[model samples]
Target: MSLGGKISKDSALEPRIAAIDLFCGVGGLTRGLERAGIDVKLGVDIDSACEYPYLANNDAAFLLKSVADLEVVDLTSKLSGAEYTLLAGCAPCQPFSTYQQKSGPTDERWHLLGHFERLAGELNPDFITMENVPNLARQSVFTKFVTELEALNFHVTYGVVNCAEFGVPQQRQRLVLLASKLGPIALLRTKTKRKTVRQAIGGLPPIEAGEAYDSDPLHQASELSNLNKRRIRASVPGGTWRDWNQELVAECHKRETGKTYPGVYGRMEWDQPAPTMTTQYFGFGNGRFGHPEQDRAISLREGAILQSFPKSYKFVRKGDPIYCKTIGRLIGNAVPVKLAEAIGKSIVAHVASHSGPRKRQLNDWHD
Candidate 1:
């Protein structure tokens, strides 16, 4: 399947693969799956904020409900007319992420995966898939989820996949899982080139620090502090804080522990994929978010594009103020749209070849 262009439709004779995107933050996965010709019936997420973007860019219903509260009937009702069902999601991955290891299963959100597993068991969809931080593979809940799918006789394949290899312009690593009762399913790689930061955002018009482009508010970059401006000036593409003049470095960097942290206040390289986009990507001190040649950090629009969202993708109404925290979290936590599209295409191919009487039996769960 192709990336970064118009949505492509599969032949009409294929079994119609309809889906429900649980934890569909900002609709990244939904948009990608739609591009690969999946009929996403509705997206279920607890964030009321996700509603606008989820409904805006994708032709699907947005249900503002926790996955824990989503009864099987809710998804079945939405997917009733579907010929084949695909239950797809990425439960919020904080508890399992390396960056936030202190948050364990005691964190209420950790059980969201368990809820997903429960729903998967009850729904028995023809296919199931999830995207999450790669660290999730080490957790017991993941083990249980996989074992249960195997118990259901679903063929499952999962592993850590580099986002750049799948056309996302960021070097984000995610654990992707695919389960199908149709046959031995796998996440075959796309026939595409590794994407780079330059390919993703090189076409955008330039803007100064704190300047919102005249016509595009999402293109606005955060204003840098006077000190940060000087620091960025001293930085080179893909270089670390060590490149800055000694006086330009922060006292924190002088600390023994901070000496090991080279990614902070760094610049992204134009020829390579960018460091993973974080919630603070708009701030110059937050990781290597600096625009490769530009003096400012990447704009919100640029970050979204790196996540493989089309430049025209809408996050809010035209007059709305772009709240960085909310939108950043939405983009940072999203399953890269390009990766989702690749997975969707793989699923479509597997179904086209492997679908048989077993697919009909699994669809019986919807009745």
Candidate 2:
């Protein structure tokens, strides 16, 4: 029943788990699950933008289709003979994001989770996992989702997990939920200390404005407009708009109303974890995105690395113009790979405790 292949007797505690990553942007979840010893059979996403990276980086087959149009049968087809099936999905959370809190349910992408619920009911995989912005846990639809899983007699564990505590370098917090039909379920243990920005990005080679680093695809920076280039020059590390000169300030910033909220137009401090990464992380005007010392925004590769993807994580082809809109959506929309790995490890521990042991040593299963 082992996935990929049978586990050796010494590593017998390993479970033969097969997983499907829904809304699998660039296979972050799939990569993490694989790292935690789960076999990722396929990844499903509506955005063809995810197809290249998803396929190039992992063994999972990438299905470029909207979750709304997916059927339980289609998903099952990918795991026809596998045992211990696990269905994992992280619906697009922009609608539930803090930035969109004022927009309410008016955001159209909010309904994508319903598709996950529907497929879960039909396929009835042994385990289910989902991750989203913490704000989602407070929504009525999220409440209903929990209630439905409870009614199905599944043992469910849901909570907001700080990504930094799980070794992700950024201070991103996500609501992670796990439900299992087999006995009880829970999350993995958090690392005792959180990781910081310097510890994570300190080792990468430095790059100049509007440039990419050698030997790293994820370290490329965004193109700067003439006006933004000038604005960024005035921004200081961990400091906000107050650092800008009056003439260079935007009209919006000049208004007394803009004086009240000052988290924008700031630079990240090297000693602390970086501000929560947003879609515009490559744009200096967005959040505390300026390099700690350099007068430029964090590069695309740095943002991706902070999100816990490998240095080689492919976003666009090597020669492409690095479409900001496309890469931003991919980065901002991803479930940080480190967080996903933690969730996967938790599930593996849960299944191992309930399912039994093998012939090989437990540590051997780590690979």
Candidate 3:
């Protein structure tokens, strides 16, 4: 057999599995599934920002289209001939995110999940999964979502999981729901000790203010405003506005309302897990965005690491636009690859136990 033919034949008998990543921003979830032995066949997203990272890092095709415009038949064409189809996605959660709360059915973003439900109804995939901000569980939309899955006769498990517990190295909590027509499904094994920031980023090459890493573009920091640079100098690691000298503080920060939100403009402590990374993580005034000990803000790469992407995972193509906003959106929007990988492994384990023992080894397949 030709080399290509041999591999293709080998793959078919090797417990072949395939997944479609919906809202596959930068393919973080897909990256995790690939780590857990599932082939990511394709990805779909509304933003062009996701195309390069999703396609370049994972060997998958990217469809730059909104889920709202598409339907189950569209997915059928994409899958074409795959044996096992896993419908997986995370609806954009900004409308329901704790960071920005604007609820009710009138919120247009809530309808996207309904679109996801529409696919589940028509495709009836063997497996389905989704992740979102933890508060989603409390919303009526979430209740409706659960109702739809159960009505379709799929066994479902949903919970709020701390991503840090799964070695994400960031203080982020998300709602994860896994549903299966096969049988009962659960999340990846619960995490034990949480991984810390030092464990995740301490070993990276150190960079000074306004400098990028020689080896990694993501590790470079944006140039600081001269006044902000001085303010940062007075800031202590793990300290908030209380650490700033009176003269160094921003006038807006001196206001009464600003005093209540001290976590903003604070530096991370080297030994702790980082606070949740936001879309504005590249900006100094957003959240506890300062680097743990570095005088400058955290680099795009640092944000990626906090989101649990592997160091080798490439976000931008060789000649693609390198705007910070684009990079930030990709990193901020990803479901941490580590968390996704864990979930994938858990799903596989559940599948394995229910099904008869296979002839081929599964761990090697995953590895």
Candidate 4:
């Protein structure tokens, strides 16, 4: 049957596919997919912390369950009666990250990909997508995933995508895969200009270290130590600790091995895209998370903004403390929303191409 006939008459009137997001941390992928006209039915994640933001930002149910515990029956219930269904699983990438190269293969998170593969085999939805660090592409697990999908008669296409190229204001690279049972599918090449850090968060009002913006709770920075404050004051934008005075240099950096890790404890350049944000992005001592002009580390909200999350995306409620560690983990672990939007658009285009006259009729109905 064609893609259009899979829907009920009620759903055909709307003519959009339904999606279920796995590992849907804070609804980044759901938000983007919805923006591309897909109806996101539910978001699943193990962390109870994700419930607030995921439900706050998207019109979807949040299921606090690990992927291992999720049953196909539960997903099918939510996705039932849709024109087509999409399954998105962006498994955590720490196990395959470049920083974890030495210990990554041994990390338990390595098996999560295998779990996702098994789930996909069981469900076999109309379309599937996954996003992860580019380092995942080099692993044997990645090849096995592609082979399994093809074995299921899926037309698969995957590539390492640069987030900046899709309008994200961070220089993050991720492996993105899109597979379809309907027809051949590939990610659309967006010709938009790359976004810079200044364009993303330049307009926010200033706040000091250890201070929260009076207007927005998430716009708060972690407190820096007295010595770190002095180190930041001496540091230049785009420059590392190597530029700091001898007194401010960490003893670790004084060693020859540490000299090669220059990206640490550095301020981001205003005109450039930011370095990839990590779970520790709120700390001044981690990566190049320091503010360009401000003498504090990038605030929690700044990191979220860099991740392409809306400034109004609420992660905490009033009366709750906006701890740096909690909010930082949510932002850093999210898929860049803009990149997800691009993937959504690509899927829409692919389905439309295969739908032929039904798609044209739907377009005319909308117009």
Best by TM-score: 1
Tens digits of per-residue lDDT, candidate 3, 214-282, equal 667767777888888887777777888778788877778799977888887778888888999888888
**Per-residue lDDT for 49-84 in model 1, tens only?**
899888878778999999989899888877776678
State the weakest 10-residue window (summed lDDT) of model 2: 3-12
Task: Give all candidate RMSDs, comma-separated.
Answer: 2.4, 5.9, 5.7, 6.4
- Candidate 2 to native Cα RMSD, angstroms: 5.9
| lDDT head-to-head 1 vs 4, winner | 1
lDDT score for candidate 4 against the true structure: 0.85
Error of 4 at 285 (Å): 1.2
**Index of the highest-lDDT prediction:** 1
Candidate 1: 10-residue stretch with minimal lDDT: 4-13
Which regions of candidate 1 are displaced past 4 Å? Answer: 1-13, 355-363
TM-score quality measure for candidate 3: 0.89
Which prediction has more favorable lDDT, 3 or 4? 4
Candidate 1 at residue 31, lDDT?
Answer: 87
In order, candidate lDDTs are: 0.87, 0.79, 0.79, 0.85
Model 4 Cα lDDT, one tens digit per residue, 1-367: 2311111223221457888999999988987887677888889999999998887677789999988778777776777666777899699988888787676667777878887888787776778999998988888999999999999889999999889999999999899999998878999996989888899999999999999988888888889899999989988898988988898899998999889999888999999999998999999898999999999999999999999988788787767877778889988999998999899888888888885422222222112
Clashing pairs in 3: 218-301
